[model samples]
Target: MNMHKLVKVLAPAGIAATVVTSAHVASGDDGINTVEAAESTSSNYKYQGDTGYGDGNFLLNEALIKTLEEDGDLAFNGHTIEASEDDYETRADKKSEFVEEHDQKFTLRDGTATKVVFPIQDETLSIDDVTEAYGDDFETTESKNGKYETYVYKLGDKKDDDKKNIIAFKVEDGYVTQGTIGYSKSY
Candidate 1:
């Protein structure tokens, strides 16, 4: 090929690369666009991990949102499906995933047995904070076996009460840690 032809062929490639680069810059892949969009929006509030992948400042295939809403699971973190009444949110996750929203309608009560599970945190939680969440009457129990300590609570009063709540707290090294808080059919 002649030198002139070779130069012409490379010219188009150069222009294409510049165009792509400029497009990314204009769309805020750099710091400028992020600042612009965030300032114009909700005062740039920060979440734990907001990656700006869900921005709507530019035109996009918005039909993708509906498709994702109907079909997507919470495979990725922070992804959740809002409930119809907005009372709760469903977070589909793995075994070890930390879920933020779950509509646990059932409460623990008396003459009932409930199994509870929670992750142990650095600090120990007192029974007062735990008791506030459970409106029912309950008693903290210690087992003779070298096992977990339990707090038994009642959901309601009277023999006609159909539901009961029991909470067993898992303790480690003389400290109350984490445990499951759930309602059970068997007492």
Candidate 2:
């Protein structure tokens, strides 16, 4: 499922729902997929595991994190890639070459790109749309190293008080659509 569909199916943004208390699902063969988003941590959040790009494995820079502190916890709004006709069945099979693509960027609260092209998958989003939404205030990255094509964007506050969240999409031209949200308290 693409990030767009994941956001809607798992975490519906309606009537002000709070952070998830707990959940356990059983995905049939497709892998038990769950979208973790929406709720702010009741306690301080912490950053774990390196983003693989840096110490925290996070893609955002020091300056950008500082900026989000001035605003509310950052939330990412994505796009909708309609799956073919009214039935959601894709007529065209997804091309494997899509992995060779890449893009990345960094933006501020007002939505401006300060950096771009680190190459992460935005199957749930388009780089252009992100550029417009984040402008020149944030940073982005892209890469085709994984089994699946991937593009990404990263943003948030200081590592000690993380308020930023990540929204991502998984693209596979034909079979299914999905999304994933990664969050941290950033201590």
Candidate 3:
């Protein structure tokens, strides 16, 4: 297995810049495959090896959202899908919006959840804890002011396709404050 690491600096005002590191593994000559760190291909995302969180599934796509709705685990927060007047080319082109319920914030694109943010609220959550829960194969960014930090773990090969899946942690004061799991068309 070969590990690749890339570092980048982004200077956004008041926000932390990023240092991204990713690992790629090659199959051995014996035909045995070594596990690559921080890779998840399933539609349902997980944190700490569990899928359920906060009265519903934490990170879900369109199909899983529908299933949760049917199972009474999720519901719309009374906000209807409305497209902007000029950008309404088609139903599929509508802008993504957030629907909050069950203490989870779901970003819906075309009535499907593309991203979900949930509260961590664990004062003991640390960077090492996040690394253990997910993996060390992640990209990290810290605030310019040194008060905030974020770690992003890739779910799939972003270089190979347009679809992006990731798990992210937002830390403040040396502790993780929140988490997010989602997918996007591009990152």
User: Which model scores highest in TM-score?
Assistant: 3
Stronger candidate by TM-score (1 vs 2):
1
For each candidate in turn, give its C-alpha RMSD to the true structure in angstroms.
20.8, 17.4, 15.9
Structural similarity to truth (TM-score) of each candidate: 0.29, 0.26, 0.47
Highest lDDT scorer: 3
> How many clashing pairs in candidate 2?
56
lDDT of 1 by residue, 126-169 (tens): 44544544433655655577565666544323243223222344
lDDT of each: 0.30, 0.29, 0.42
Q: Worst ten-residue run, lDDT, model 1?
A: 35-44
Q: List, residue by residue over 112-177, the lDDT tens digit for candidate 3.
A: 555666665456456665565455777778767877888766543335322334556777876676
Better of 1 and 3 by lDDT: 3
Clashes of each: 14, 56, 0
Q: Assess candidate 1 and give its lDDT.
A: 0.30
Ranking by lDDT: 3, 1, 2
- Tell me the RMSD of model 3 versus the true structure: 15.9
